[model samples]
Target: MASKANKELESWIKHLSGEDMPVFSGTVADVTESVNSEDSSASEVAQTILRDASLTSRLLKVANSFNYNPGGKKISTVSRAVMVLGFEQVGALTLTLALVDSLSEGVQRHKLTEEMAQSFHAAIQAQQLAKKMGCKSPEDIFVATLLSRLGNMAFWAFSGQKGTEVLNLIQSENLTEQEAELQVLGFRLRDLTVGLSKSWSLGELLDDFLSDHHGNDERHNIISIGQELAEAAKNGWDSEQVAIIFEQAAKKLGLSVDEVEELAHQNAKHAKEITRIYGVTDASKRIPQPNIDMGLIEEDVDEAKSDSTDEPRLTITEDTSTAVTSKYPEPDSNVQLTIMQEITSAIEEKPSINIILEMVLEGLHRGVGMDRALFAILSPDRRTLTCKYAIGEDNERLCKELRINLSNTNNIFHQVIDSKKAMHVPSDPKKLTGTLSRDTLTLLGPPAYLVMPVIVRSKVIGIFMADRNASGRDIEEKDFIAFQQFCQQANMGLTFLAM
Candidate 1:
């Protein structure tokens, strides 16, 4: 029976391979172009936004959220919304809007449980910790807490009916959701999110925040605080263990125990606010979407039609609407030699990844107007992809929440991991239609994306991603060559870091 189940799983995976992969939108590309343009004025930014009605509306809605104003007077214009939020918040809101818009509308179910309420409570607890630690923006704490366990949402989105089975295994069998997902699906949602975030150009700050599982730094420590609180509050971890993690974290972050307690109280207060916004109920049986029921599944297969320009027939799969299975250009010896010379010379110098990633990402932003670029290192176990460095602007908190479990099926990161190769998708809206499922698309944000695996010897060591503007432009040969060179240098740098 076990062997039969394995065969069926393999067959399903193979069938999925033949189907088209999902594609992300060029939202991040837009953010990139707007920020990097010659003028880069508020007017240019507003003009750029005028083109996308979705971003306009999302900006307004988030502006209306309690963070913006204590009172609610609906301001009706994008410019007005921008005025209210300032440029930084406006940019963040735009990314957030694009992300929410791209989520899948597929049939899946999420059961809101007492534990769900408890999770919110934990998020608030984390916020309190941030405040106690003197984080100026407690709201950053709120956002961090809100999204730390978003992998839970990803699981519910992908698992369909067996979400419960997967959740049960996590709880009863003492497994992380990513581990269980590997047993069931070959990849976990975390894997999908990291690749998707890079592809969509969600920005480096968010990329780093989302994938920073290590809670060592000040920024990452907040997310670690939140995760610990959430696990304690929802999972019923022993109070002593929770206190230990908290005390140790607080000491590292330079906060007192009294301060941590006050933060926990704030968490309790904010839990109500989260509940009100999402309309989650303690006893709710289903997450907002329906469970996957193939019995009720509708196939919307378009007749195999050739592209107008005679490229490959890009099938729009339930996962994505874009065709992005192209190979990356090989490294250019000229560029590689220069970059490698710089890297080798700098090894003893110990350059920051920020400086290095910026040189690479900034070049892409200049060459093709990519918004941002990021890189991740696969864990020694190869089960997790943790963001190591990023370039571009956004909140550091979001990066802290980012992590990719290698088992997630919904993301292109896993594809890069498995194939140990490069993945690129063009930004033509026509081509992007079914290349990415809505949710993965939304989470990642920018549509036009490329993922390149960094291999040393035969072993896969890391992955690099670059994203273009909302235009979702295809990576030209020159750009691909530069990317390969960048990867080669980056791999060497990381190797040095390890040594």
Candidate 2:
């Protein structure tokens, strides 16, 4: 019943179904050679690769469909591709396409079933979704989508007749392929895809999408939109219905549906064409142009399908406060996650360690309603904590040269250093000596204050001191504990940096 061309195509592709197909060398070599090129001509060389008619065409189709190439005249030259994508980037892109081609070779293709056409359609739709969403790197969307369904391909290749049965049920049943997969293979296609992605060492983002795409993660959502478009192709869904589904999906994935519709449509068309150029087909039945609403319902249905396999939830016995307790008893998971986030955020915003101290000083000054805040770190010699950053008093810099002896009997710094832990000083500055003991407070200066040592790697590294307004009141127990927690977090951050 099938055409001879289709039968031959299936046989050749089935040869690829072997689990032991040698890693496609041409693709890897192309990427390696590109990377190894002399720096001076890297750009030119990369341009040449993009300029190849076949490669250029593929790239354009991918870019346009992925929704990444800013709309203009269709890109026809490698020079333009190089300029738009850059040299290093062009290498990355070439590598991606090369990988896709190599992997798809041995994949089984039932020629008459139009499987290859559907694959191209899905890939192009994914790229368009990326562009429409204004994704910074829509090329990635193309790559992710192109590779997303490889798991299903490999399943068919290896399982042979059994795989065909699964595919048959998927096309016949209105249920998801994942459900049919469970019936036929006892595991999900996603599990296979993730395994292959890991084995191939694909980029982290792609790996994330492959593993997490069906879930609430955005990349997953984008790929889902691609699949939805592919489904639309089969169902003969009208543009309006497609737009509604697209808009709903875009909102869920934080994309603008109205703005991306043209892009999505273009991408879907391109992916369909590209996959057709190859030899893949969709196993799902095409829905004819169906009318659909665009809104919360779409999101709910999609998300529900994604999370359906999750295990049942059990009651949590721990209270919220106690749940924050450290998983790592010594290092403290709660403290680490908190401090790491703060330090990473601060560094991400402003790339300086001094900025961290400034942040601490500002928080203490305002958050505690303090008149002044001082942050001092011990010199490498361990003699004193030099005032690195401060807020409040104008003479804070004048006190920059200040140091408290680590071994001095009257020094509170010595007590904290000796203990190798936090020591809180409340309302009793007179008990301390030297600069710390300075009772300018007795002269009606800033009244209540607290000082805690910054310990890192079992050694006292710095000291943080905060002075309250001239109210002469004692610090509250809760406030002291909060301050202690803050110091602990700071200590953990500093320790991590030291490592």
Highest-lDDT candidate: 2
> What are the lDDT scores of the predictions, listed in order?
0.50, 0.51
Off by over 4 Å in 1: 1-25, 32-39, 43-58, 71-74, 97-106, 111-152, 161-176, 206-216, 235-241, 278-499
Off by over 4 Å in 2: 1-108, 111-116, 157-159, 167-176, 213-220, 239-244, 253-261, 272-499
Across residues 188-240, which tens digit of lDDT does each residue of candidate 1 receive?
55654454455545455446777765445565667666666655543223357
Clashes of 1: 67
lDDT of 1 at 416: 75
Which candidate should be chosen as best, given TM-score against the real structure?
Answer: 1
